[model samples]
Target: MNGLEKKQDQRRRFLRTLYDATGGRRLTFILAPDIGTKLGLTQEEYTSTTDYLVGRGWMKWETLEGKASITPAGVDEAERLIAADAPQPERRNIPAPVIAEISRAFDATYTHAQIDNIFMEASAPGAPPEGSKLRKVAAWLHRINADSEVDALDIFGRLVREFLARPRWGTDLDPHAAEAYDEEDSRFLDALAAHGLSYHDGKIFGAGLLAPSKTLAELIRARDLTAIGKEFERAADKIASKSLGPLWKVVQRHLGIAPTPELDEDLKRVLGGLASIVAGVGAFRTHAGDAHGRGPGAPSIEPRHTRLAVHAAHTVVTFILETWKGSK
Candidate 1:
């Protein structure tokens, strides 16, 4: 290049050497001919550049022996040049399946607005580029993991731990009760299957509660009280007629009650309560669950109400299954 451009380049190298050696905080020897040789500059060129920087207050010599340090302004200039020469971070493309899974987990737990806020925080001091909230958050997650900022599994694990810690049903119960209370639909259904009332191809016989229970779960997820209540009524009917009828035969033989259509008084009362529970769940759904249309003053249905219905269903189903198993 031209002489002037070449001189500017040499000055940059000198400042960079000083910045690297001491970050501009301590003096470095600048007089050695080998120093200029290492920088690909002749002694004359090095001396000329050093004098130019000193005159501009960009560097100062501490002694005649040439111990020198870069000035604050010189350090700033060096940093700017370094940044200008640095490569930009490469944009990474996240796969659709990975993004879909991430979005599903977060959507299940967070409100739309809350999720937006989370994405904003994760990419803070700068907002994510224009896209759907899911896409933006997914991209940020991918970028952070690629950069070694944090592992994606660690983030997911934290979310799971937080969800487990929170009282999803809004109750303050002991861990044992809560564990039984929060029986997932799949787990509860599996328990019923082992007791000879298995679900298959979306249909289940004997108990007949299986299909409706599955429907109830979906409705609950959607926060559909009216549909949930109607399904609960159907499930209760199945529990009373289909589920109990078969189980009662076994109970009669076990209790030494004669094989007859009529149940003895004591056993009748106990079994009747089971039917009553089913009826109660259905009734709760009818009145409070919004199964039927309401007046303007009708009470609002909350998540706790749905949770209560599900928990009651679990109790009935579990008791019946365990009873049947015990009798066998």
Candidate 2:
């Protein structure tokens, strides 16, 4: 083949590999070895191809430790290839029963709050729950007074398989499967496993046991602020033993807000106060008088201090979000 043909072939192969990577978690960091093994390329070939792509500014890489990640450009290229080569089938004509079954499965797996949130986002503006696609199927069953028929079951099964195979909505299955397994197949399996769903022979069977969708998972994950606060506190305590400056620097990084010299000094004072409060609390608790009203000094568990710390964290997050929005 000519040089042009060889480059085209390499691009096509890279695109195919990237499409496979999308099958679970839509956008994610993938290691070089995994990509190489998945694409049926030797380590050398994979490295060369990736390097060439990156050099051309079609892809980017980030290395932490020895692992490398494909940049956003790589993902977009892969998606574009899939769109060009394997367009998704139209689902508008799909039977109502199939939609109902899938919707029911989603309901069973997710909490009421989660379901409501998803429906709200997916539904058209001001539409009733029953007007939403998922809820529409559920409503159809109620109106017809019948369960999903065999044809509906088949359609649902096919749709499930297809859904599982797609990137941005599915999961990656066995990364160690055959050297040239279908990317879609791997993604479906990966998604099922990631969400704690059961799969057998490339079919989803127990979606009822899986956690909520990725969007819901993100919300739930972010809600664990108490644990996050404790972690910050621990880190702050460690840094306090050394110097408050380091901890203040970390806070700035986390909040994505640059600190002026004045801000830095103010942050140091806050950290010092926090450290003193923690120390004072420990000391008082350890050497308290017998009566509750006869403590050595004021109580260390000041609601105002806790509230301030929490407020600071919230303000930082808000400032970061505002900055991000403004830039966009």
Candidate 3:
């Protein structure tokens, strides 16, 4: 085919993939890399095709980040083309990688019996026959996704948070899961309160900071990687705002700078660096978190990564609080 023909083919495939993923009813974000791999397109081809569609107002995407969603126009176009073509087979089964990721997460925290209990609670009619918990659970997930209206992955995610909220333990649940992390979190809050900053309705009043740190703690406990990265990014944005914006005045006072209407370039650079570090947490979330749809090829985020993110947030917030208090 000629250049224009190849380009059109790629565009059609891209739009079709997005439509299939979401039934064109919802705007679902898909990673650019996944689209490229699935379509067997070169980097240049992917870039050119994405830009063309986005320019034509057929989709919304940040080419730099590779997170994209088809717009209504794009959906209409895809639908038109689909109707002109022969009917395609419906996709029923959940991707194997997705199923494996869910299974690993469940197995790590729940024993075979607990798995059975969760499955029973979450599954609709026609639960799988009793047998190997691992094999049976996997089989049931495939069956349900193929046969039921509800998406299998969504059911598993809901099941996780529900069971995790109750007091319980599995054979493999981390013994150290209940370690002094809460104490550290409490101390951080106490330190803020000591500085006369009170938290209410998810914000620290005096600092004018959106503090979702507590939410992060709960997500960490639940081991919900999907939520953890997104929450971390949110908390990081708030901290970064304080570090880089008007709060910089307070920081300057603490730095012993004379009252001046103008910002000192040198000090700004230093603060900017700190703010960037804070923002990096959010960046991490965009890449690794389930705030957006992750492709099956994306590596599963681990418990250690969540712990690291939480600790990093704690450290940054602690530093900011200490600086603000010292300025008083």
Q: Against the unseen true structure, what C-alpha lDDT does each candidate score?
A: 0.57, 0.50, 0.61
Best by lDDT: 3
Identify the candidate with maximal TM-score. 1
Can you give the TM-score per candidate against the true fold? 0.34, 0.23, 0.27
Per-residue alpha-carbon lDDT of candidate 3 for residues 1-328, written as tens digits (9 for 90 to 100): 9988988999889888877865785457778668778999998998888888889888787456777888888889999989979776553344565455445445555678777777777753475546665666667666767765665544544454443444533424765645433443355445445553433212223322324476445544655455435644555554545433444444444444433447687776765566555566776777777678677776665445655666676666655555534554
Candidate 2: regions farther than 4 A off: 1-3, 22-27, 64-66, 87-328
- lDDT by residue (1-328, candidate 2, tens digit) is 9967876777678756655664423335567567667667766677678778777665555565434445556667776777787865432223344445456555444455554454344321233345545565465334322332323322334445434443442325645443233543455345545544444322334343232334344643655567556757866866645444466556556554443455678776754554444444444444442235544464344334433443444444444344434454
Cα lDDT for residue 295, candidate 2: 43
Clashing pairs in 3: none
Clashes of 2: 6
TM-score winner, 1 or 2: 1
Q: Candidate 3: which stretches are off by over 4 Å?
A: 1-94, 104-113, 123-125, 163-328
The alpha-carbon lDDT assigned to residue 47 of candidate 3 equals 86
Give the lDDT of residue 179 in candidate 3.
48
Worst 10 residues of 3 by lDDT: 201-210
lDDT of 1: 0.57
Decide which is better by lDDT, 2 or 3: 3
